[model samples]
Target: MRGPHNIIRLIRTGATLERTGAMKVILDAYEAPRLLRMVVRGVVWPFQWLGMKGDTSMPPATRALTALGPAYIKFGQVLSTRPDVVGDELAVQLRVLQDKLPPFPIDVAKDSVRDALDVQVRDVFDEFSEPVAAASIAQVHKARLKETGEEVAVKVLRPGIEKAFQRDVDAFYFAADVIEFLSPASRRLRPRDVIAHFEGVVKGELDLRLESASASEFAANTVGDEGFRLPDVKWAYSGRRVMTMGWAEGVPLGDNDALDAAGHDRTRLGERVLQLFLSHALRDGFFHADMHQGNLKVAANGDIIAYDFGIMGYIDEYTRRVYAEILFGFIQRDYKRVAEVHFEAGYVPADRDVDEFARALRAVGEPIFGMDASHISMGRLLSYLFEVTERFGMETRTELILLQRTMVVVEGVARSLSPQLNIWDVAHPIVEDYIKTSIGPRAVLRDLAKTAAVMARFGPRLPGLVEAALIRQSEIEAPHNRGGHRKMWALMFLGGLVAGSGAVALAVVL
Candidate 1:
């Protein structure tokens, strides 16, 4: 009953499993010997044609995925984030899958809005034109708010995207579950869990409401900050299927000519954008995770307006502190502190010697510090840090990965605008200010005052705490407890009995 494509995909999957050393386990877990045979037959020739003679060549995986279509492209993109699962070299290659889809048809865009919004084109917007840019899930249009005569950008969901994405996601879940069952190394990476997380992220991306909320929250976070802003959401026109935002009139940050014609200073704008993002990350603990040139615009006054808030990043107070400390340590060439912070945050394995790890970190840092400002790249620096962390068995953090990806894109855009832009110089002052306000005596006083007020409110509970402790001591001393030793012995005996029974059961049943 299998189609040619399905048969080919089966072969591709087996080839992947074989190369990754999961072939037998995959066969055992999936219980699909017949399919495995078919897979090997279907994939062998295409792979040979592609010059991937051995099981180890990931170009086979890449070619096979591309052959399988959109679903595989999405899978490749997901795998790109999981350097731990796919290995660094393969992950790097898979990064090509990001936003590689051709744009959908223009008619489909118009019909999608009409069907979703239940209105004709003229009724909704004064002028709804063609798609400006097309991406994986949707394409954007330039339009105007009908009543207000205000220009707006309308994002229309690709029709049947949910169904298409759902099919691929279901397939991904199948693959993840099978991989986790078959490979212990993959289980440590939690393949199923990673797929689930990807599912949630992509699902959230599909829901226009969540994206709007992300925009609203980010807008609020940057309200007081200067030189950077987000497009105001036109809530009345926004929904699950569509997002309408204030029409921004500005040149794309990557277009040097347009930026110059608009009277914007590329160097200054680039510096502001870099500082703004770092400030949001280090100081506010939240930031827009998708800041590529297409999603960003520069107004005549040089304010950078960030759009496409479907993806964002957040770190808690503790993560914030650790992240800042790591940056501060790297800046000062204090690899010891950086290593200690990794240990303290439980990022590096405790058994690893801190001095050894610090030495590894020094290798990543020393080169950056030695390089001229123009020669240094925050992207490359982060990439090296990831490489070092991987040596220590640190799995990628999604938020941090997203932050790094966004940084790479933003930095690239910035450099394109002004080739001489110095990211380190642009970021240093913001990082310094954030460190001062966050960890200094002034912050300590503010936190202590807040803590004192909470303690004053809980003052009456001190007597209750004493009474509870006295009652616990009385109960512990009671005779039936066997001095609290009987409970421990009983639990240990019960656990042993259960283990013994499990062993007997496994032996007898198998």
Candidate 2:
């Protein structure tokens, strides 16, 4: 399925774009060169008959992506946030891919719930309504628990979605391979690795149980966070194919009219959204990666309600520290420090000149600083950053893909709420606080404590390890000196252990 057969898939993709009248619009938005546009049209136009004939009422781009399957729909959702890249018209059209796609039949959803929970729908849900929202992987139904009489949202995986996603992912792998082979420049971005990461995330999302667990963990992590909340997971009602959580009542984040009607402060809401995302990413190292407007809402009391925990992002402590340093450097306009941090984290190749790289970074950062959100263009900034990374021999870090992408999407979401929001102003304090906690003397003590705990695990075996080292050293030395060598090695090892233990004690006391 991932072989030459995918050529057919690729052709169908292009043909769908052609037939739906999206090919030209997309090419034009991307500013494709004359020759490239001519070549693309020549290649894709002839096979337009092979394309899927999607709903005629939908916009061209939306219809094409919806007809293609879940993967393309997800792609469209991401593009929806990048109006600067896709153009405002197409971005508006693609917003439907977020949570308003046509849903499966209610009967089918009920059958799925029954099969997953091994109980009749009527027995478990006292009032199960039709799908209130549908997206790429799953749809949500407004329901009431029979036992507790509590309202909940029951999410059921689309029928045959696994096979649908796998098919599209296979085609994506083939396309990535072709891109890498045909264009040497694209290799630095690791197209295939990006697809592999997408595949892993989709697979995790397909299992409702994983989403339920993710929601639970995110809830626990954010319990202390103010003005942010997640719906409680209904564990007993959740399964691989079906998930249930407490119903969230709020106005969608995208509905500015409704938010205003409800007296929610859009500017403050925007700032809070950005701050919450940063806090989760830097402090907890785990965040809701898919934080588009569709997954967010504002309650009557102004608390932001987040639901649909399918795709999440996670960075380790070290990576989080590096990220914080880079951001803090930018906030302070310390381009050299930002460049140094990139090198220290091995994100840029060692051969790259730090001073020159710092200059390149300055080119990227300086333009955006002191500029209002309305003046700055994140899309252009990201494009320039991409070129800089490519020039410096920085390969795509797969672990940070979700984090980076979510940052872009979240920024878009925040801006939608408050068009004049200053992203840098909102982000500075969070990054600064993270840096203070994660990069100083206290951080060193924390690291030392962790190291000591790990070393303590080997404490019982130290004597045996020392004996083995001494014996090996004595064997390597002259036979006559074995006794003296053993004594000397023992003292050195014992002294080192004492010093290490003393340091650990001092750290603990401090």
Indicate which candidate wins on lDDT: 2
CA error at residue 213 for candidate 2, angstroms: 1.2
Tens-digit lDDT string for candidate 2 (406-493): 7777788888989888787788888888898899888877777766766667666666776676667666777578677667667677
Least well predicted 10-residue stretch by lDDT in candidate 1: 49-58
TM-score per prediction, in order, is 0.77, 0.84
What TM value does model 1 have?
Answer: 0.77
How much does candidate 2 score in TM-score? 0.84
Which one is best on TM-score? 2
Please identify model 2 stretches exceeding 4 Å from their true place: 1-8, 21-46, 53-63, 75-99, 177-189, 376-383, 466-507
Q: Count the backbone clashes (under 3 Å) in each candidate.
A: 1, 0
lDDT of 1 by residue, 344-386 (tens): 9999888888999999999999988898767778877777898
Clashing residue pairs found in predicted model 1: 11-39
